[model samples]
Target: MTEQEYFTVHHQLTINAEPLPEGSSLPSYPIFESEIPAPFIVASEFSHLDMLNDSARKELNNSDFKHVINLLDTQNSKLNLLLTFLLSQQDDPTYRTITSAFGASQCTFLSPTSLNDGQYVRIKLFLEHPAAAIYCYASVVECQAQEQGFDITVKYQLLRDADQDLLIKAALNQQQKLLRQRSLDRENNQ
Candidate 1:
């Protein structure tokens, strides 16, 4: 490896992954089992959802236990409708389990479709926290044809500081989970 490449640190993780939907078109059905599906939320839409979620949380923040259920019940339909509307706009989304090596600057994952060098991509993943989602833009660095389509590597282009921190935390957690799994396997074999 080149000196620069050798100096880069990466953490590997296996998760479901998916390509983003194209042209603002939503598939008729929901995307299931996606490892990471891009959320094509407009700024206004994001603001709306954020406000709604915040309001929802505030409603029950310190309410009496009896009122918590009532608050959720009152908002459930609106929240469901909003979520349903958002999901309807994504294109043919497919989720497949793939292993990836990711760092703050870049990520590598297997793709069922061939991607050209320098192609733009958006990578999204969620950590243990439901509210924590990683949404970053990237450019394809390499796309080598392997088994089905290509083994693609992408460099981050539009990663925010908050998103980068999220990635770092998720990567570390994934590494520890892998290590624990390996140790367990070794013990079982012995």
Candidate 2:
């Protein structure tokens, strides 16, 4: 698919926080709903329902939970960064399947949740597929609510060379289209 079809310049805003840390029971955060304008990088055009497991789906459906946010950053050749967000406490899983030209080594989760730095979360992904099933762990780093959804910034912690190569390929193919869409969005917003 063309990058334009996969990405938009618009932001989604919401408020809900759930904390799931390693070796600890899940904790619930108070649900706060609001809208905020934030920038995002769309990683794929695929739907969330396609890649998630049954448990993930149920967790994502909660009222405090919001939609997932995806972002892609292709800066390094060895690793491409894919960032995703679970906007609310509602339990609706986000899932996607990617075909990789290069294979991945490992995946890691970063920070869990934070109220500062504009609702940020970070996850490091490892790839293991030519057509592989990859599981990612994400920790919240910062969060805030606005007019659209929740504004967030996330860091990718663990990535391998194969993961990087696949991201580079996807980005190279989509860069032009993504740029065009960004331009269009700018004009519309003004």
Give the alpha-carbon lDDT of every model. Answer: 0.54, 0.29
lDDT of candidate 2 at residue 173, scale 0 to 100: 39
Runs in model 1 deviating more than 4 A are 1-99, 128-131
Q: Give a tens-digit lDDT track for model 1, residues 63-125.
A: 865476566657755654555455444323464434457765677778888776766665554
Error of 1 at 31 (Å): 27
The residue pairs that clash in candidate 1, if any, are 16-35, 26-89, 26-90, 27-90
* Candidate 1 global CA lDDT score: 0.54
Candidate number of the best lDDT: 1
Query: Where does model 2 exceed 4 Å of error?
Result: 1-19, 22-134, 179-190
State the TM-score for model 2: 0.29
Each prediction's RMSD over C-alphas, in Å, is 10.1, 18.6
lDDT of candidate 2 over 44-142, digit per residue (tens) = 212122234335646665644544311111222122222232211121234111111111221112223233432222222222111111222223344
